[model samples]
Target: MDAKELIRALNARDEAAGPDLLARTKATGPLEIRGELLYAPLVRNWYELTDSLELIPAKAPEWRPLQCGIDERAQAATGYLLALAEADVFSGVVRLSRGEEILFEEVYGWADQDRRRPNLPGTPFNVGSMNKMMTSACVGRLMEQGDVRLDDKVIRHLPGFRPDITARITVRQLLTHTSGMGDFFGPKFFAGGRHRLETIDDHLDLIRDDELLFEPGARFEYSNSGFVVLGAIIEARSGCSYADYVREHVFEPAGMRSSDFPAFHELDGQAIGYTNFTAHGAVTGPRRPHEDTLPRRGSAPGGGYCSAEDLARFGAALMRDTLIGPDVKAALLGLRSDSGSGRPGGVPYAHGFQVESEHGVLSYGHGGGGPGISAFMDVFPDQGLTLVALSNYDDGARQIRRELRRIFWPAA
Candidate 1:
């Protein structure tokens, strides 16, 4: 019934499950958990081992599975994460999917303290800039239908796009963050230095006085203004508001019913984002509501909420050809430069996703961060796997992604 007993049974099942995409040994090589390699012989291949146990119970009803179909590794991970959640590190969900099928979907931590409600599988958490991926998807669909192309110049949609030094910027440059737009947000937009700006025009107006950081497409500079502009272009081109276009085409097609670019006041079961401000992990601050965080209402650059399950379904559908056609999907995953210099380069920013190659496998997804929350969802095409993690508190989803990557896909 306990984790140890479940692990032993799972070990037996794993040996028989045969070769899986998840490495059985040294999968922990690339990842370190609290200064130690997390995967050992004792807990390698946890997913299969645990999944096999589930199958056996269904096949033989006479024997009752004492545990609730959860494995030791999951229990250990949950314990560690819940400890962090209680300490206000974060609250969200972690979901694993293989193609169109979800293998594991679990929620952790409280959605709110005032209501004393814990986050369940369907609880929604804001994805922040991670919503850029969805914006990109809408753009890709437009391309698929010949409404646009990556090479199209921004001026095609917005004549004012090039009124200054931005005239040569292309759709691809904006999507890849290669536009020469300044990374700085205007001082007029700052509210006590929290970096919240409202309205697409408000964002553009903030940056309007600044000169281009570099020539268009010459190098990469992450500019939120670029996607804000893209959202505007989506609206102008689609003849609908950017949010409505994405909700109708991208979210609906992907079966992500729980996902939306909702107003802050509209959200009912959503968790407010939070950030920790301690080394010993004591003091914490919740992210002010988006309305309080931004100067504008709802702009396409960011502001979307979704559950882990919904995100996994979205990723699975994208990989399974339910969203776009084959040619469009290829364009979506192709590697392009993301000129983020502080981190390692060579990661490609595709249509609405990041194409990262690790251990001879391609993992594509985006991470979202807002005032207080962080979220990440990666789809591993080689293994037909998708891993999604959402955190109500800042920095929580990053650790979850790093840890679960090892647990589900250990290095050989």
Candidate 2:
């Protein structure tokens, strides 16, 4: 097949590109094609070409959020969310701010279905992978304190943590998902095994032996295992557990009183996650409590809870160098890697943030979604805008975010 035709087929997921075809397509180099996985710019995501000739979406587009209010000019945005709420699709909070001014804010749906408790603007929702920002900040705090360096080997802080495998990985690589460590998800993680892992140190037992996917500092791959190791390093350097370190250094300083990796049982009146996702990341049917699909609690990689206000506080603090220093924040948010990491082309992964520039507008943020949780927060530094959307229903934040984006940045 021709190069263009091959790219079209791969993107459509209708025709599989074998090794010979992939090599041929790479030689063409006309469509920004990468080896093994296809980087389809049109889709703004990466797809893995399995041996069976099936194309699987590796990750979703990793950027964009918005700020606006309900007015005649923004009726579409407001109506869109109201429509979803009417359909029982949206359940959580949407907060938008320009500096200290709240441009828009609202809450909808039930926090507790059985209790008939409605969601409030203050309700905390599990932010699937959004916790990675704080994990990054934790590492940055240590970096500022001279307790760690990005280039230092992971084995330095976590010497006993898979020394044979971690010796080659660096702190920067781990933060940027370039450490080559795969995720801990499997039948074991989804099955009854998750309950046994309550603490960050306990998760070391869950890291698979066959975790290495590529050489250190190679291509970018989303890794829960890498963050797990970073969490361990945070504990070792701070002379305390990772949770304690984050609470004292990351959250308290940032005024994120409502954010933390609280366990399911420890939670009090937080919005319960409602997911349609099964263990394998597939939607089964209607949304329900996602307790069965969750780990015992959130950890370094993600699964922390936060309210929109708390997240706004975090974004502000992060930008203002409240949790980390100026140079540290800039270096962490700088484009450090540009491998095929499922983000839009030219939008590389920063330390923990995803940096993007579209239509001459620069923004950085992170998104997390799984089953009953869909959370996203973005900061538009030039516009002085911070947008946060947190939800309890399965993939509920997407529509809200898209509408808000259109409302605020219509041409984008």
Candidate 3:
């Protein structure tokens, strides 16, 4: 069958057949056209577009020679990224840099779908969980000043912490997401309203009474509440609010002039976050505004606005030891857990960065996602390459990153 017919057939299949049958069918072979393979993964109830290219044949007549050199690869990457943008697969800003030189940069899609404001190269996008890196840097600075220690108990900083539950949880555990604390985004969060939970202390009631998911340091479990507690620690030790501390210590030092944790309604050159639905009813694709889906303001664990260029600047600063000392930076970027074992891309988890091994080379970065935003930033220190992608749509950044990685590191 042709592509359209194949999609129709796939869509007509019984939903009760489930992912197992779909996986089995996909394993048979993807449809091939002009040397390219097409495989769509199941998303929720339907097949969604994904990047899963696998070269089965030794050679294809339509294939071009591999551009392995840096300049050649950069050109190929730019062309590929433009094509993806043209095809509506990628949206927002992307930048790839080597050392101090930017190899490629492009912007796509709309910042405000209603106003038709095109997403400029400097458009700030909400980087959901990526703010954890900034929080980590604040902790690192506090550690450098002899204000805190990794092994120090959580109760040492937050006196209100439960003696029985959080007493054994250390700062290190919080940083590495091994503290066993559960997330704060539960029934209470929605009930309490986002505006009320504006500060680190504001989230304490949500977490203070809750029990741990497991014993501290037992395993790797992502805990947004753990980072909230860390933010409290930063405030208690540094005598500054989480946002203020990060701005002064992290963003300012990193030369990230365009990054901030603004209130939800603030839209100053930042993209208007969009999703597929609103409370009114089912909205059309890419047009539904996510105004009620965001917090009044961002906090320590996540929810910060930054441009792609600002993210690249943050990476460069981390590498140059501008934000934290060398020892602190090393600890912050060090591999602290094997959290990526079963992850989609097999990328390991570092202190605040995601570590990925491509062929024999390693790269460090982080990705963030939420209601209507997705973001990714990577720094290949060995090759002096840094990549940053920020999108206004929830599912836009991942596939773009995948395709760009293939362009730069084809062997992997």
TM-scores for every candidate against the unseen true structure: 0.74, 0.80, 0.83
**Decreasing lDDT order of the candidates:** 2, 3, 1
TM-score of 3: 0.83
Give the per-residue lDDT digits (tens) of candidate 2, residues 1-412. Answer: 5447765666566443444345333322233446655663321336665766655656544455344434542455566667667666678888877656777787889999989998888788999889899899999889988999988998888877788887899898888888888888766787667887788876888884655899887687888888888899998988888878888987898888888888888878799988766644543346678887778889898888898988888888876778888778877887434322333234567888887776577777888887789889888777777889999887678535545654666212
Q: Write the per-residue lDDT of candidate 3 for residues 1-412, one digit (tens) a residue.
A: 6644544555566443334334333322233333234443211012233323222222212323355776777777667656656655457887887655777787888998878899998889999888988888889999999988888888888777687866788888888887889888776776655657777877776677888898888788788888888898999998889899998998888788999988776667888777754544333344566667766678888888998888888888877878888877666666434221212234566566677776666777788886678899988777767888888875668545665676676321
Q: Is 1 or 2 the stronger prediction by lDDT? A: 2
Tell me which of candidates 1 and 2 scores higher on TM-score.
Answer: 2
**Best-performing candidate as measured by lDDT:** 2
Against the true structure, what is every candidate's RMSD?
Answer: 12.8, 8.7, 6.2
Task: Please estimate how well model 1 matches the true structure, expressed as its whole-model Cα lDDT.
Answer: 0.64
Decoy 2 TM-score against native: 0.80
- Among residues 3 or more apart in sequence or in different chains, the pairs in candidate 3 whose N, CA or C atoms overlap within 3 Å are none
Predictions in order: lDDT: 0.64, 0.75, 0.72
**In candidate 1, what residue range of length 10 has the lowest lDDT sum?**
56-65
Give the Cα error of residue 213 in candidate 3, in Å.
Answer: 1.0
